[model samples]
Structure formats: C-alpha cells, structure tokens
Target: MNKSKIVVIGGGTGIPVLLDALRKENIDLTAVVTVADDGGSSGKIRNAVNIAPPGDLRNVLIAMSDMPQFYADILQYRFDETDGPLAGHPLGNLLIAAVSEKQGSISTAIRTLGRFFHISGNIYPSSDQALTLHAVFEDGTEVAGESSIGKHEGLISHVYLTDTDTGGAPIASQNVVNCIMDADMVVMGPGSLYTSILPNVVIPDINKALLETKAKVVYVCNIMTQRGETENFTDADHVRVLHEHLGKKVIDHVLVNIEQVPQDYMDNNAFDEYLVQVKHDFAGLKEQEVKVISNNFLRLVKGGAFHDGEAVAREIMGLSKRQAD
Candidate 1:
C-alpha cells in the first residue's frame, strides 16, 4: 500500500490556512511556497540579505508545525516602532535570515527550522534565490517589483519571474520539480492569484512539471476578488488565466465557493484587497473542460472572509482517496 503524496503550491495567508489543516491529516504533504514577495518585512529583509524572502515561509512553517501557541507567539512577535531599525520585522524572519547566512542558502535554512519547529510536512520555496515579479499590464506597460505590481492599478496581462539580485531567469528550487512530478495530487491557490499563486507556476521548470505530472491538479479558488489583481474576476476568469499560462486546461478540478459573504461583512479598512465577491460562471467553467467542486466553503472572522481550512482539506483528502481507490 502506497501512501498518497500531496503537493500544494502557493503562498500568502491562504496557503498557510490550508497547510495548517493538512498538517493534521495522514499523508505525505509538502508546500511549494512562492519566493516572489517583495513587500513589508520581506522586502526589507530581501534588500538587506541575499536569502529568499522568509515572510511567507515563516507563516507557513508556523501553521504547519506542532509548536505550541506560546512558542508560535514568540516566533510571530513583531518589533514595535520603538525599536529602531528592527521595527516591523517578525522574530522568525530574523532567525531565518541568520541561519541562511550561516548555511549559505534559504533552502537549508527552511530544512533546519522545519526540524526545530517539529513540522510533519515538508516546505520548499519555489525558487532557491530571491525572485522579482514583473507584471505586464494591458496597456503594454511594465512594473518591476512585486510590491509595486500590487500598487499599480491596471489589468495585468501576465507576470514573469527573474532573479532578484542578478536579473536572470528564475528556476524552480531543488526538489520542487521532482516533488510535483512524483506526487499523487497537486493543489494550487485560494490565495492572491497574481502575486502568490502565479509566482510559483510561472517558473519554467515548475510549469513543465505541472504539464507533465500524472498528479491530479486541483485549484482552490479564492472566495473574494482582490483589488489590483483579480478584481471583478469570475471563478471562470481565474481558471482561464491559469490555463492561458500553462498553454492548456491543465487544472483538473477547481473548488469554488458557492457561499455568499454576509452583506457589508468585510472590513475593507484592514484588508483593502477584499474588494468584492468573485462572480461565478459554471458555463464558462464547463468550457474549460475541468471538474468544478462547488460548495459553501466560507469562513469569516472579525469581518474578514476566508476558506474553512479543514473543510477544504477534507475535500482534497476525499479526492485523493478516490484517486487511490
């Protein structure tokens, strides 16, 4: 009997939520996190150090680890404004930077920290080196950084990756391609479509694996449309963009949230990206020739809308079972 291997690809808060739930399940779970982040503490760290951005990985590691709340709190602690030069950085990010400097690679740093965190699932960055995301808007204009891309208000035609320091083409991190090809299933998204999810698949080697892998590729669609990214996009539009990138309808299943967010429930002040609920087009989805797993997967907290991690994980687990059986 062979255990099912599931590889999830993406970053940001959404992927971590799914991972947090998947960590408790019995299977071979691994995360392929995006390294195209260049904002906030991650940007500060990337500019100062040569390591891959640690912010996403920090959130990911904490979510998937067996660490107690107390230790997780310690790692998540942020320096207040009173702390000169250290303000806005998490303790975990600093720790990752320190270890990466000693080991000469962020991949090594992730492995070392994974053991300390007592993580059951493996975590791998999409690329070994830091990545810069460049977006081409509908007007043929180009924006150079991931931080800036989110701020630029235009329909993004496409996004591509490059090495942060040397401006060379980006490659998949070691073992990332192998993990994808050998997996029983691959999950993508429920995160920022352009910045978090696309950053990983847009890498050449990763794209090839997705195209060639026998694994059932599933896309967990985001509940809310994000401004400056998937604003005004339907569930089908999201699928179309992904298919356009991969050159075919590579996604086998797409999980859509049929549940509606309560009226005026979103706190746009804190999360400006929560622009509107994503519209659905089942006919459009059918045109893509992929299975749609529609359900009431909404989970709200303090006026913020999110996916029910355990619910989504259960659905994925069921799919894996069906595949294995």
Candidate 2:
C-alpha cells in the first residue's frame, strides 16, 4: 500500500500520543508543533538562551521514534533527588537544548534527532520565532504565556501571536509548508486551544500555507474543557473558535467524541487536576456546517477522560481512506 502523507498540527502531550497511533498505520506523518510553551524546563532553557521552545518538538519526536523503548526513555528522563541546578529538568529537554546550540537552529537539531532515533515520521516547529501567546478575555483583559492564562479563570475571547513579523526557523516553516502542500489530509488539535492550536495558526506563513493547501482539514476536538481558556466551550464552540481564527471555509470536517465519560474517573481527579467536563454538542457543531464524526474517543487516564490517541488515529485513517474512495 502506498503511504498517504499526513500533516498533524498540535503540541505537548497530544501530538506525541497522536503520532504514536499514526506511526503504527505506516502513514507518512509530518508533525507541525507549536512553540509557545512558557513553562517547565522548556521555559527555563528558552528564556536563558534566547531559543525557541523545544518541549513540544521533543514530545513529537518521541511519538514518532522507532526505538521508543530505548531512546524514548532516555530522552524523557528527568533529574531529581538533589537540589542542583538541573534537578527538575528532563534529559530530553536538555539534549534538545544542546542540539540547538550545536546545530545553530532547532530544525537542524530535530532533523539530527530524527535520524538518530529513526523516527517513523518527520516533525517540525510551527514557527522559528520564540513567540509568546496572548489571550484576550471577554472583559478586554489580556494574558500572556501558557502558564499564566491556564489559571486566569476568564473567557478567552481571542488569541494571536505577539509578533507575526518575527522570522521563523526557516527549515521548520519550509517543512510545514511542504507537508501541507503535499499531504492528502491535515489534522489539527486534540491539544490546548490557546497555547497549542492557536499559536500555530497565528504564524503568518504557516496560516498562509494552510489556506493554500488543498488537503482535507480535520479538527480532532478536545475531550474536556479547559478552565481559563475554554471554560464553557462545547464541541461547536471549539469549531467556531478555530473558524474565527482561521476562517470558516478552511475546515472540512470535525471529529467529536460522543461517548459519555465514566463518573468515577471524573470524581477522582476533578479537584486536583483542575479538569473541566466537556459534553457533546452535536447540534451546535452541525449548525456550523461541519460534518461531525462521532466516536468513542475517551481513555481512562489516572481517573479522567483524556483523548484516546490510538482510537483517534484509527478514525483518522478510516476517514481519510473513506474520503479517498
């Protein structure tokens, strides 16, 4: 079977999980990861060295890794036990930082890792800029950075890049454009709305490339609501936000999970995890002219309804093939 090229756009935990599923399908995957993370070891490294965020890219690479049982563990290993400077940092984050220094750019470093780990698919940053995310609240308040906005407890009215004119890592942007142009389908989201998904769309060249691409655009909606960013967002609310950001005509389909989440799972983590319950709103999505593919997409993760990456990937493959037919 000829491998169909796919461009998956997202960041953080979601991308890695999605890639893991897609890689097993033997598809030619190209991940366009957001670079707006401003917390954890990624933030520490980027701020100190004036470099773009590497955490998302690192996660993507692990998702596509051929030897995940080996290199994946090494890459994700975190230091602890001592109060040293590197105590809280993940080994993967540090390695990526070193690679960035040695190779002179994040893209170059990722390409090297891709080769070293024999990653099943290619991964690229959405932009080269060390960009920051700013969210405008319904009350006209603005919050900058992922960490700050997560705790804002306000409705995110709009989101945009702080500086769209700032140059991106040329290699990453080129790869993203090329993937979009060549792909049979482009997958967006199943990640954070403001920081992960919007950050990528706000990149000037990336958005232009997406608009120009002829590929079928599929938005894999998130399973649960986010507190400050997407407080009351239904499935339709998710689609509307993207349409408002990227325009209505850009998206072709929306994949939503219709299966109900287990009550006990939510009960355990509701308070500690700051998790928000997301209910299916089929009528709302249908109103926007988006054909919704409803499925069971929730996985029990530490007592919560998080996206089941493998299930999502299987649906994506099935839908793409059905479209092709």
Local error of candidate 1 at residue 172 (angstroms): 1.1
Question: Model 2 lDDT vs. the true structure?
Answer: 0.80
Give lDDT tens digits, candidate 2, residues 1-325: 7788888998977767878889888678889998888898888888877678788888888888878477678888888849588977889888888988888888888999889888887888876657777888899998878778887866888887754235333323777878888899999978887778888886766777778888989998888777677777888888888888886558788888877776656754453533566667888877777888888887876666678888899889998888778
Q: Tell me which residue pairs clash in candidate 2.
A: 128-168, 128-169
Top candidate, metric lDDT: 1
Question: Which regions of candidate 2 deviate over 4 angstroms?
Answer: 163-172, 267-274
Candidate 2: Cα lDDT at 99 = 89
Q: What is the lDDT of residue 6 in candidate 2?
A: 89
Best by TM-score: 1
Q: Against the unseen true structure, what C-alpha lDDT does each candidate score?
A: 0.92, 0.80
Model 1 deviation from the true structure expressed as Cα RMSD, one decimal place: 0.8
Could you tally the backbone clashes for each prediction?
0, 2
lDDT of 1 by residue, 266-311 (tens): 9889888778999999999999988999998999998899999999
